[model samples]
Structure formats: C-alpha cells, structure tokens
Target chain A: MTGRVPEGLRELLAQAAGEGHAPWRTLLKAGDWALLLMAALLVAASYPLLWRGGVADRAIVKRDGQLVTELALNTPRKYEVVGAIGTTVIEVQPGRARVLSDPGPRQYCVQQGWLTRANAVAICAPNHVTLQLSGRSGQNGAYDTLNY
Target chain B: MAPMTPSTIELPVTADDYRIARYAAAAIALTVAETALPSPLPGIKPGLANIIVLVVLARYGWRDAAWVSLLRVVAGSLVIGQFLAPGFFLALAGALCSLAVLALAQYLPPRFFGPVSASVLAAFAHIGGQIVLARLWLVPHDGVFYLLPLFATAALVFGAINGLVAARLLDLPAVAPAEAAA
Candidate 1:
C-alpha cells in the first residue's frame, strides 16, 4: 500500500507531517460550533411538538364507524358495546377511558390501558369498537380515527 | 529476428485505486465490528468506521474519501447479509448524504473547517438521510421524527470523537515517511 502512494497525496502527506498540529486547527471552527448549537436548539424546539398533553374531560364511543354514545369523563360509568364479534365493556373515569374487556385475539384494546387526552383513543378492531377522547381544545377532529 | 509483441495487455493499477481499497477495507472492518456491539438505541452506533472516511477525506481529498465510503457501505452490507434489504438502502442513503456534506464542508475556509467540523457535518447528514428514508419507506409515521433529538445528539458526540481520532492520525509523522518513500 505504501509503495502505491500517489504523487499528489504523497506531497499532501509530507505537508501534513511537517505542519504537525495543522489538522487540529482545521477540525473545529466557530461556524461549526454555531451549527452544533443550532442543531441543539432545533432538538429543543421539537420537544413541544412531540409532547403528549394531559387527559381530556369527554369520551366518544363509536361502533362500526358510527357514533354509539358520548360519556362525561367526570361521571364514572361502564358501557357494554355489542359488535359482530362479541361485546366490549368500556369503562370511563374522571379523566380517562379504557376497555375493561373485549373479545379479540390479543385484547389490544384492553392493553392500551387508558385514553385521557384530546386525541387519545382505544380501539377493539375485532369488534369494530372505538373510544376516543375530546374536550376544551376542540382538536377532536384534528386527526382521523385511524391514527389511534 | 522479428520483434516480439506483448502477448497480453497489462493494465497498470493506479495508486489511487490501491489507497481507496485499503481505506475502504479498514472502514468495512470497523463497520462489521461495530455490528457485534450492543446499541442502546436503534439508530445509534459509535460510528467508528466514520473515522476512516474522515481520515481519507482529510489526507487524500473528497473524491478519494467518497470512493472509500461508498465501497465500505456496499462491501460492508454484503458481508453482513443486508444487501438489498431496508438496511442496505438506509446505509446507502446515509453514505451518499454524508459524502455530499463532506464535499460542501471542504469549501469552507481552511482555518475554520477541519476534520472535526467535517465529521460533525457529515454525521448529521448521514443520520438525517437515514431518518428521512426510514420515515418515507420503513415506518411511515411521525413517531420516527421524534427520535431525531437522540440521533442528532449521538451524531454530534460521535462525530467529534471520530474527527479527533482522524486529526490525530493525520498528524502522525510515520504516515508521511511511508508516502514520501513511495
């Protein structure tokens, strides 16, 4: 490999060896630091956009793409939703709603644990049942139910 | 006596080809070795292979560095059995973007731009390219972009480290003697 060193690169290498600390001088500049700081700032800015807000005060239950019922999150209650597959039991608390039980292979809806934010949702796809949260922000219609 | 004609044409191998091959092999070795190490994050790796690319870029030039990097990506993916896989595409995208960034960085005033800055710029470009490709083809979710902060931070730290290593290597007197002898 050493035997094949090109003429141009050989000269460059000699210059590098002669300069000693020259490479270090070129490694980091003020502009590079500025770029690094900008990247950090960009990351900081994304925090709010990526943040998930707190739970909302209302819940909407939909069965087979149609509105089934609306529940006041403050009022704790349980509702039984019947679908083609089987019944799904939905429970609503002061600020959260979740699937207590659902007939599905994986019970993914129950696994979702809870939905307490304006756009949070729990769906029992096997039974075609969905429980979505909506409140003050009126961002209820912001995203499609599919996003859940 | 009839003049003897050469039986076969022998193409001379250029010095550039030998150099690129050596650097590419080193980069590939580093990449394969890195795969064996456990990573806490999906996209984060120490990126040790990047040091070779940085060294080649600083010592040789952008063109040689590009050749070395592209060869490493292709050869590395082949060795790891990621050829034509989503991983291969992602790697290719990252390599291309990083090379472009390195080329652009070369134009900066020499006093303010060196291996460290070039490495950092390339690292960011590499990660950015991979994330964009992943979001477009692999995951297709906004969730992927959320990982940018983690990836960017890793790129900065690793890039700076790799740059330092490259700069130190470039400054070595031993390397010059061998090239000078050639």
Candidate 2:
C-alpha cells in the first residue's frame, strides 16, 4: 500500500469518503408563514374543550388483571365501571373523574384527577396497569396515508 | 452530466481549487450522511449537516451560511427522493429556523456561548417550528404532549451532537471555501 492505493480501491474510497456540500434554491420565497400560523392558532384555540367534544377510542377498564365486564362505555355519552379488588368510587366531578385506592397516602392517581378529553390519561399505578384514552387518528383528516 | 462549477462567473474556481471544490465536496458528503443514516423510523433525520452550517456561518457571512443550508436541503432532499414530500417541508423549516438562529447569534459578541449553544438554541427553535407546522398543514393530534418529552430528549441529545460537530468542524483545516461567496 504505497503511494497508489489500488485504482478501484482509491475510486471507492474517494466516492465513499469524499466531503459534500449543496446547490442553490434561488427561487424559494417565504409566503406561507401567516397561513401556517393561523392553522396552528385554530387548533390552539379549541384547546379548552368547551365547544368541540373529543372522541377517544373505546375506554377499557380492568381490575387485578381481570376485565371488569360490568364497567363499560355503554353509550356514546354514558360511562360506568365496577371492580372486585381494592376498588372504591371516590367521586366524579364536572370535567373530571377520580378513584381512591388503599395503596398509600401519596395517591398520585387521585391527585391526577378530573382529566378532560384534551388531557386524557389513566393511572392504576399500584396494579401496574394503565388505560389511556387516545384521540381519533383515523377520523380526522390529519393523516394522508396509514403507515400500514 | 458534468458537475457544474460554482455559480459566480466573475470568480472561476476549478475542481482542484481548495475553496469551491471543498464546499461542493462537503455539501455532497453531508447530504449523503444525512439521508443514509438510519433513524428510529424512516423520514426522520437529525439535521446533522447543521454542524457544517454553524462552521460556515462562523467563517463566512449569513449569505453563504444560508446557501450551504439551502444546498443541503435541496440536494439532500433530491438525493433521498423526498424533495416535494412532507419530509422536505420539515427539513426546509429546520433550515430556515437555523438560519434565523444563526443570524440572531451574530449580534451577540462571541463570549459565553459558542457553536454548541447556538446549535442547541437553533434545535429548540427547530422543533418548535416543525411542531407548529405539523399541527397546522399536516396531521392534527391532542397527542402533542405524548411527543413533547420524546422530542425534548432528542433535542438535548442531538443538539449536543450538533454543537460538538460544529466545534470540530471549526477546528478542521479549511481545505476549501465556498463559491458564489454565499
């Protein structure tokens, strides 16, 4: 491997390890900033969930590794649940829901209460289980093509 | 097709000329690195060429810096066949936001912050701009919070990497300068 590295090897090395830069786009003009801003603003405006109702995919409920059959989203608007193990109804408040567990006083789940559609979450930290209400990805025109 | 020389006719530069040739070479190299690098998923690149941009910005003015960024976006996008896709838009937004940050960083005296801080600041702004764009013309989701932590983590990691590269590039011998002077 003196001065002349094999011609093919040298060519390969040059192509593979060469430095790079780019060309000019002397034509790109900044015109769509305002429209993009407006669209973002529109989405941000609906954040309070006062006017537009959120539709999360089916909410599943379980207790102690067993499906809680009784508790179900019976109707589009109605909701109810029941459990046999360590389950107790704390209370339901407007714009929120809650549950009380005998696990500990820290009660991170209870403190994380009254979550609306925008802030959909579930915490059964003690049972090592969680249920999350996901917003519609299929219904909205947000997607052009499914990854599948 | 023969590779064209730099745009300026007034200053003719050959392939052997260190200045123009080196920039052209760096552009192609960065473009390949950006497109070929695997990400967590497809259409996801870390904008790694930003290190080169920060270096160019330091050595040259805003104009050349902008050109390098523009070239990377265009040539890189074309090379990867994502020129007109949504991915292109994301890269374009990142480039523009970076240019904005680099231009702003110019005002401050080269004191406490260097390329790393500049790159990090630009990365933060880059994410913000992309999120804003995605929420608007692209997909809509209440899942922004779900992605916030992930993007934030990525920024911290990638931003440091960019800053490090920028610093490294700054130290490398300037083998070539850019043509069209931008």
Candidate 3:
C-alpha cells in the first residue's frame, strides 16, 4: 500500500510530524523532572521487593536445579556435594557460606568469596551445583528435613 | 511488438522513504558499534542507538521514528549475526515497548513533556519488556526480577543521556527538515 495509507496511520504520522520543536534544557521540562523523580522512586521502591538484606541463617545446596541439603548457618561446617562433573565443597560459617572448592574449571563460585546476606547464591554451573544462603525471612524456609 | 512490459513493478518512492532509510541506517550503525563495548552483564546495555530514535521522533515524527527503530532492530540483528535468535527477539521486544510508550507520550503537552521525558519513559518500557520476555522464556525464574534495579538504573542514565543528545541535535541551527534523498 504505497499511496493508500490508513486513516488512523495517517493521523498518527501527521500528529508526530506536526509536533513543535520545543527548546531543551538540562532537565528539559517540568514533566521530565517529575519523571526522573518518579523513576528514581520506582527503583527505590523495588529495593524492598528485589533486594534481600540481613544475615542468612541457613545454607541450602542444590544439584542440577534440585535441592541437595539444607544446613543451619549457626554452626560452622564443611559440606560436599557430588555433581555433574565432580564434587563441590561448600563451607558454612556463622551467618554466611562460601564455596571452599569446586571441580568446575572457571571456579566462579569459589571466586564469589561469601554469601553472607539472605538470598545470596553461588552457582557452579559446570558441576551442576548451587549454594544459596537464606535468612529467617528467606523463601527457602518453606520446606526442610524437620518439616518433612 | 504488442507491449514491452517491465519485469519488475516500480513503486514510487517518496522523500519520507529516503529520510527514513537514512535514519534507520544511522541507528543500525550505532547498534552495531555499541555491541563492541564491554557490558557489565549479558543483557544490560547503554542503548546508545536510542538517541537516533529520539532524534527521529522529534524531527520526523512517531511514524518515522517507529520505522527507524524497528528497522534498526531487525537490520542490526542481521548485521550482528543474531537474526531470529534469542537476542533478536529481545531487541524487538524492547523496540516495540518503547515505541508503544512513545506513541502515548507524544500526546502529552510539549511544554512539559519533551525529548528527555520521552526518552526516559521509553527506556523504562524497553527494559520492562525485555525483562518480561526473559523471565518467561530465557531464565524462567523469579530471580530475573533481581536485575530490575540494575537495569532500571541503566535505563535512567542512558535514556537521559540519549535524550540530551537528541535535544542538542535538534537545537543545531544547521538541522532543517529532511531534504529529498539525494
């Protein structure tokens, strides 16, 4: 449809083309400043929903996306998980956990250093192992050995 | 000799077509170049090409801007060897969302809503659309939401920057209405 433009499309095109060439400032205009503020506020509001703070009370380990074991972080302990490639060693100290060693070549999980905060995770994808730390409010508390 | 019919039908090309092609080419160039820059995450990007879209929106109109933005996504992906791949769809999703937002944002009072405001709004919508698609298909986990703050921050920073660039481009005395494609 080279020349046959729909009425609605024509109107939209005209409306866009007809827009004024307004002047620009750093902040641009009143609505722009307001939008910036709103965007900041929106991002700020998402912090509570997306970010988890406070010390994690438990360390949950998974292999191949399935739960392997859950250990309390109150007691320092060393745990081993047999994974796709080899065993992954996880160390849990009071309120925190870390990957002591992993068979994965990259050692990304080992480099992660620590998972002290709630919802912290160390994933060794090559070994199909994942270690996640959870606080009292963390979602991982939904099921456990005691509950089962 | 009854009739000498041309093998191909010639469609009349308008000035808008040439202008749009030029704008789309510029946008695609930016997209391809931006890919060379290192990113902190796999998906998060500065979206520098959006500046061209903002300029097209202000100078040409929403229709031309939409054409330019979409053509950039498709052609850019093809140039980068990502056509019809996961990355292509993500780019397309972002472009569509931003265009939808810009369509409505255009109606707002120009006195209050200018290029910067439109840029910021489109940026947010762009990320939002990508996140939704990523969550549904790629990652398939709620953990995707964890990236919201980071992506949102990128959108705000890059969106405003692109908008400011567009504003400056619009203000240049040399920039006039699109001349018929040479």
Candidate 4:
C-alpha cells in the first residue's frame, strides 16, 4: 500500500534484485534478436506450406457458451445458427458472416462478421448463437465436420 | 562473457551477461501458474507470470524481457505441448504485443507506472496480438465479431498482478551488503 518498503515485500524484492547489472541491456538485445529469429522461423515454416496452398484449422459453433449442434457451409453458402430457446439466427456467408437476432441490450453479435476460415467465431451474447471456424489446408476433404 | 562462477562477490550470472534470471524465473512461475490456476473455461488463462516479463522490461531492459519471453514461449509451449497449437500462437502474439507496450511504457517514468502498468499494457497488447494472429492464421473470416468483454477482463486482472510483482522487484536493494562493501 505505502509505495515504499513494507518489510516482507522488501525482503522478496531483495530476492529478485539479486546482484549485479540487472541485465537490462542484455535482455533488450536478446529479446529483439529472439523475436526476429522467431518471426523468421514462423515465416519459414509458412513458406513451405504456402507454395502448396494455406494452413487449415478446425472451426466449431457455440450457443450460449455451449457448442452448437449444427453448422455447414463452404465459400458460397451461408450457415445458419439458431439457439435452443433464443430468436437469434446467425448466418454465415462467404468471406463474411452476419447475425439476424432480436435486438437486445448488447448488440455485439449483430455487428460481427461471417465465419469462413478456421478458428473463426461469432457470438450473440443475448441471442445465444455462437459460430466457430476450423480448417487445415491441402487435406483430403479439406472441409471437415465435428462429427468426424 | 562467462558466468560469475560463484566467485565470492557477484551472483552466478556475469556482469555483462544480460539474461535476467528473473525472466526465466517468471516464465517458470507463469507456466506453473497458468497450469495450476483453476479455470471453469478450458484454454483460457491470464498467464499470471507475464508480470515477471513486464518487470524484466522495466527493471532490466526490453532486450532481456524479449529474450525471456521468447524462451518462455518456446519453452513453456514445449512443456505444455502447445508449441504449435492455435492457442500457442495466441500466446505468441500476446508476447509480441507486450513487447511493443514495454517500449512505449519506457517513457512513462518508472515511479508513475512501474511493471504493473507495463504488464497491463502488455496484457492488452498480447490479447490484441492474439486476436490479429488468430484472425490471420486460425480464423480469418470471422475475425470482426470476436470482440467481447472477457478480453478486457483478462487484461485488467493479469496486468494488475504483474505490475505489483514488478514493483516489488524494482524496490529491492540493488546490491547485497557484503558484495557492495567488497
């Protein structure tokens, strides 16, 4: 509470401060180098995959914090998500998605977009419709189902 | 430079050596805390140890924090088997975002903000980074609608804890008595 020393906290502080230069400068240099290396590694990893196509991931649908029962769509068609007891219908169109639900206090889901790619999701808190996305590129039946 | 080798005075690390042990310690603590912290919702953790990373940034330097984070992410992920999971990527994005926040917070005199503020900023940046990365790699199409209140909540709680720890780290005596007297 008192911004200054408070004994117990001070003792622990003594523990971390430890001894020497505090390695502040060394840490900066190391972090930048590491991030650069990591970015390079990621891009490098993606490069091999990119020449072929793209990475695919799994997408799922959730309603009211629970997984949704059904969702199916490709590039052109729209996937509809309806909550068990809610009036919300989440529509997923190509490149983008939208929600059609009775307006409530939080209109967050209505302003959200479509779920096309892997790991994409749309949640209408009040309406209780949640759309999740998933896929991994260059696979047999690139489009997968949760049942699978 | 070689490690201090426990020479009667300096600690195990070298004078020029910059790998802040706190970063390593924090990563370990965070990884443990992340795993140990009870969660009703799976795969959602605030990464409490990031406070250590934030403190390292303020007390030592960004380079140290960055190195610590890189190692922590890679090491922590490997330990948890999340090295390449979508969630792992989110954590990576968060680490990168925190780095940016640390740089900006550098100007806000230590007395005013300290590690907690920097960490909170990092937590927000980390979440932003995760959202952007997730949208790019995992869920590109539905990126826009992912926004919600939980993101803010996660940032606030995680940031406050990280800051408090960092403040404690900075307040300690710079040198031990015998070593200083020598």
DockQ of 1: 0.17
After superposition on all C-alphas, the RMSD of every candidate to the true structure, in Å, is 11.1, 15.2, 12.7, 16.4
Better of 2 and 3 by TM-score: 3
Please report the candidate that would top DockQ against the real structure. 3
Judging by TM-score against the true structure, name the best candidate: 3
Candidate 4 on A118-145: residue-level lDDT in tens? Answer: 4455566566666555544435333343
Listed models, DockQ each: 0.17, 0.04, 0.20, 0.05
lDDT of 1 by residue, B8-96 (tens): 76667676676677777778878898999999987798888888888888777889899989898899999999989888899899999
lDDT per residue as tens, model 1, A46-120? 665554443366788899999999887776799999987999999987667899999998988898887756667
In candidate 1, which residue pairs get closer than 3 Å at backbone N, Cα or C atoms, i.e. clash?
Answer: A26-B114, A55-A116, A56-A116
Residue A32, candidate 1: alpha-carbon lDDT: 66
- lDDT of each prediction vs. the true structure? 0.77, 0.53, 0.79, 0.56
Of candidates 2 and 1, the better by DockQ:
1
> After superposing candidate 3, which stretches have Cα over 4 Å from the reference?
A1-27, A53-148, B1-7, B174-177, B180-182
Instruction: Flag the better candidate by TM-score, 1 or 3.
Output: 3
lDDT of 3 by residue, B111-130 (tens): 88778888999999999999
True A-B contacts kept by model 3: 0.44
The local lDDT score (0 to 100) that residue A82 gets in candidate 2 is: 42
